[model samples]
Target: PRLLRAAGVAQVVPPLAARDGRLHVPLCRQAGGLQLAVFAYITGRGGADAPLGREQWRQFGATLRAVHQTPVPEPLRRALPTWQEPGEVGRWLQRALPVWRRQKGRTAAARALIEVIGVRYDELQALTARMLALHQRLGERIAAGELRCALCHSDAHVHNLMVDQQERVWLIDWDGASWSPIERDLMFVIGGLSADLLRPHETEWFFEGYGPVQIDWPALATCRYAWAVTDVHAFAIEALGERDEARASSSAAWFERLFAPGEIVALAREGEAWL
Candidate 1:
């Protein structure tokens, strides 16, 4: 809350489900709305794929840049868990594997999932083991000059954003927020934005608006596909009546996408770049 003032937001109001990755608040007049900045919900079914206005998305990205630029207050930093630590990522992946395994036998599609994911239980176990190993390896790289990091709105897509009647886009969920390769945010929003909501040319313009930064679509494509797997995991878990478990496992799949190279290369070539 205190950290937000540093970010220029007036306040961080409490919501009924704040801990559950959502915020529902009556809009303050300055919020420029009818009195709510609720967590976005996909209207009419396809869930996260639902419509998010184009102007709203562009504004959302801009808002995120501002939010990311905000400094963390000492007290708030003390009060909150430090996200993006290697230990945290490792813990998250470990915790999520069990959840994924639990659903293994339950989902009729579990077998199909195993095939699509290119892993069996043992395989996933080994892969996750390797992921932890690589986590250690990447930690070394990140600590050295090899990698650059930035705070990211892990769920950078438009669905997690809401624009009031004023058209001021507000970012909602922070469940997956972390410090990662700066490209995580770019690849995420770019890859996941739907055909109806986004087009490649528009996305190019969007990235151009990010000011000055490299836009390697192939690399971004890598991150995007990894995110896609997680998206599928999220949808399936929510459908399976296990929302919390879903979020964790699905998010793991997302991380796995980053670590797993074959998937990334394939996604880049596949033009996971949809409209």
Candidate 2:
């Protein structure tokens, strides 16, 4: 509490109503006796339905850069851990994988995801295995070198990022916060933006000041493909346990379209060829 106060966030905004996750809130101050609002990042004004624009994402990148400028005090820094640390991804994976691995497609909720996977069994299988391997291997790079350590929002998708009433970019959802490779942000931002089925270079606006990541292209491409599998599974998990069969199918369709193979070889080799 003292640390938060010291950081100038006298009071956090009242947490907004969230279904899956909400990133903005209202707040007040005690010492100053001021009623004000605060945000974890730029909160967009788009209601529940609209997505962010390309320029919006460019600003998001800028805000993310600004966040990097604020040196985290020792206590906070120590308190935060890399997302790559053990027990982190594993936990999310545990809850989600069961729904993903189910074959019978009996779980009415997972029908969409199962259908997506069912169509590309051989490809999805290879991709999933490769991604798991990379995570197992490169996760060590984080501990050893802290190569791309930054305060990552962790969940960098469109839903978490909102432009508030003032049109300032705010990244919400600290629940996924961690120190990690810059690519984590990329995975959410660039990787996610790709889901819109836009051309790869179309994202140049968002990449302006962003630095390069120390990525194994083949590895990342492999991981990217792996991520498609994982993300679809995640959506499936979220959609599962629900009574809405139509919505579940909708969920699966979203996964299928987003995770389709565009050019794995090209994406894998986007940087240096994977070793």
Candidate 3:
């Protein structure tokens, strides 16, 4: 908060301090000695389900660029985590294996999910492999310095953004903030929210404000697929683990919209077209 203020970034919600000039204070002083901090109130309504207007979308790009461009304090820079660090790429592949396994007995449930989603078992397998392959290719580029990392709000999405009464935009939800390829943030909005809102123009507006920056197409595609697949697969796995047939089916149907044949590929192509 202090650093951004010093850098002249506008519409940021800084933490409030208590009487003792401490930024963090006890959370009710009873919840297991938990701590919390107060933040300035942002008066606006809209979320992942309800998106802000087009103009606001452009402002979102500008604000995001401001955040990424803010000079990182040396200590904070050293502490932040990055994408594809160590075994991170392998972890994504490991989590997605169940989606490609054979269906027999307990596995039948996962297979039935593939059937219900209108996707063939083989198609799901191909998608998983494609996502993993993209991850590997991008991972190599990341190692070779073709793609650069920056301070990113890893969970940046419409739901984490706010447009106050004055029409100023604010981005919240700092928990996942990290030093990562900026595409980590770009993929969520472009891949997930854009799917629901059908707002392709919003992305153009965003880029207009964000200015010019290299877009690693493969890396962006990897992020888009990996995020969706991991999330939907986790949802399905949880429901199956609990033996909640209805929820499991619901998750399957939900995931279908994301991974149905040609859907993700089309999304990736669309994003690349603009880039």
Candidate 4:
């Protein structure tokens, strides 16, 4: 939040101190000073329901570019989280795969869901393998100092971006903020969830305002694939935890959309062509 403020980004509104310059205040459970949990209010406009226009998308891209260009303070370098050393999706699936296998064996319902997942298992594995390769390239480039790393909003999907009344684009929810390749941000808007909503010329306008920066296409492709698959994978896992038929059914629908015939294969071919 301080970084955005320093970068002259007026869109971000961080939490303020309740009193004594404390950003969070605790609620007493019984008497006083129990320190159960601290809380702060964040102000922002728009939400998942908000509809965005072309200009907003351009501004969104500009805002992200502004963030990426902002230098990380030396004091905060070690404190801030980083990415592309290992892809987040890879790590998440690593943990999830074992749990999923266990669930499938123990629960008959999980077995039913597993059958649905199995239909696309080969494609999922294929996408995961390609993304892993891209992650390797990203790691090599970062390690060799061939790639310039900067602050990225790892979850910069449309739902997280808020548009104010003045039409200014506000970037909220810094939970996934990390020091990573710029492609991580770009792919979120271009090839991730928001991709389907963007018109072709609007995409061009985004780049126009964002200025010319070379993208590691392989890395971007990896991120793009990871973004889509991670949502479906996470949601499917959540559905199992929910034990609700509606949510589990919805998860299956998303899995189908994510693994649409030839989609992952096409993305793999395109990414390979860039290499």
On TM-score, the leading prediction is 4
Write down the worst ten-residue block by lDDT for model 4: 34-43
lDDT of prediction 1: 0.49
Model 2 agreement with the true structure over 195-232: per-residue lDDT tens digits: 34334553565566444434434434434544554554
Alpha carbon deviation, residue 264, candidate 4 (Å): 7.6
Q: How much lDDT does each candidate structure score? A: 0.49, 0.52, 0.66, 0.66
TM-score of every prediction relative to native = 0.53, 0.62, 0.73, 0.80
Candidate 4, 12: how far from true, in Å?
A: 1.6
Per-model root-mean-square deviation over C-alphas: 9.3, 8.0, 4.6, 4.2
lDDT tens readout by residue for model 3, 1-275: 54665687775677887899997888885699888988887767655546567777778888888888889988988988767542354465455555544333234454576454334445555655666666677768878998888888877777787777787678787766778778887776565534555367777777787788876666676777666555555655654454555665566565556554446445654554433
Candidate 2 ranges with C-alpha deviation above 4 Å: 1-44, 47-58, 73-81, 85-119, 164-166, 188-202, 209-226, 261-275
Displacement of residue 27 (Cα, Å) in model 4 is 6.8
Give lDDT tens digits, candidate 1, residues 1-275: 22444467531222335555454554676766654434335233221444555565555556556555666555644544332353444446456655655555334344344344445445444534543454455556667867665556666665665545564555666756665665667765564434444556556555543555655454354345444434444543443443354454554455345434444323433553431
Model 3 misplacement above 4 A: 18-35, 47-51, 85-122, 188-193, 241-253, 260-275
Candidate 4 stretches greater than 4 Å from native: 25-51, 85-88, 91-111, 261-270
**Local accuracy of candidate 4 as per-residue lDDT tens digits, 67-102:** 888888887767767765346666677556545644
Worst 10 residues of 3 by lDDT: 99-108
